[model samples]
Target: MDSKTPYKANLIKQQKVCERNFHKLMKLLPDLENNDNLVLSFYLAGWEGQARFQVLERAPYTTVLHVNLDAAWGQWLKLPEFRIRIYRDVRMAEIISVNKDRHFKAIYPYPNEKMLMPDEKEQLNQLFSEWLNFCLTHGLNN
Candidate 1:
């Protein structure tokens, strides 16, 4: 087998994961379809090494949720990741990341939050659910 075979397979796996999660988000928040600012790209861009999903914030004046993949699949270290940022009237209020070292950090505007690590499906679901509610409460989805 060629060395690139594994790498290619890893990439494909990562893409599938991202795609599944993207669909999950869509299922969770049907309102996402109404937001023109929302961009769902399950696959990596031509120049991007990571696949990501982004959501724009309403109250924060221009925030965005940037969900990124830390590394290719099959890598010894690396996992799904994300972050929140601000842009021109397009910011994401919450910040989150799953690092290559398996450290997961999520900062939210709300209290009583927990730190989530990669491969933790329950935690990940909670995180997304909270974010969806956060956006709804902040009037982003309206």
Candidate 2:
């Protein structure tokens, strides 16, 4: 066995973990059939700021969710980034006058609100684990 091989295997394992997390989230959401008005954004990062994947979706009466595997936290913590944005009053005449860009900006700011907050780093790790299970079982993606 080669020394470098072990490092390569570890990298692959991490990649798999990220992929599984992404798929698990997607699978939890309801499938879109017709209309096309919803939008989704996903950012994939590894280590510091290495981006690996980006996905977007658009459909009516749909929910958009972003799932990210935050590798920066390391083993001491498991940090998963989650975001949900809902658009409303699109079909109304008066609401149609609203600025599209500005509305989107207001809903999705640079920083998002957290659904799960823990008192400590260790607690945060536990929260992430619980979140993964809850999102998977409760179908919170949509």
Poorest stretch of ten by lDDT in candidate 1: 86-95
How high is each candidate's TM-score?
0.27, 0.28
Residue pairs clashing, model 1? 62-89, 62-90, 62-91, 63-90, 63-91, 63-92, 64-91, 64-92, 82-96
| Each model's lDDT | 0.40, 0.32
Compute the lDDT for candidate 2.
0.32
Candidate 2: residue 4 lDDT (0-100): 43
Lowest lDDT sum, 10 consecutive residues, model 2, at 92-101
For model 1, the stretches where C-alpha displacement exceeds 4 angstroms are: 1-9, 35-54, 57-63, 66-142
Cα lDDT of model 1 by residue, 1-142, tens digit: 4434321223344334444444445553455435534433222223213334556454435434555543344277554465543332321222234343233332222222453323343355345545444333332221
TM-score of 2: 0.28
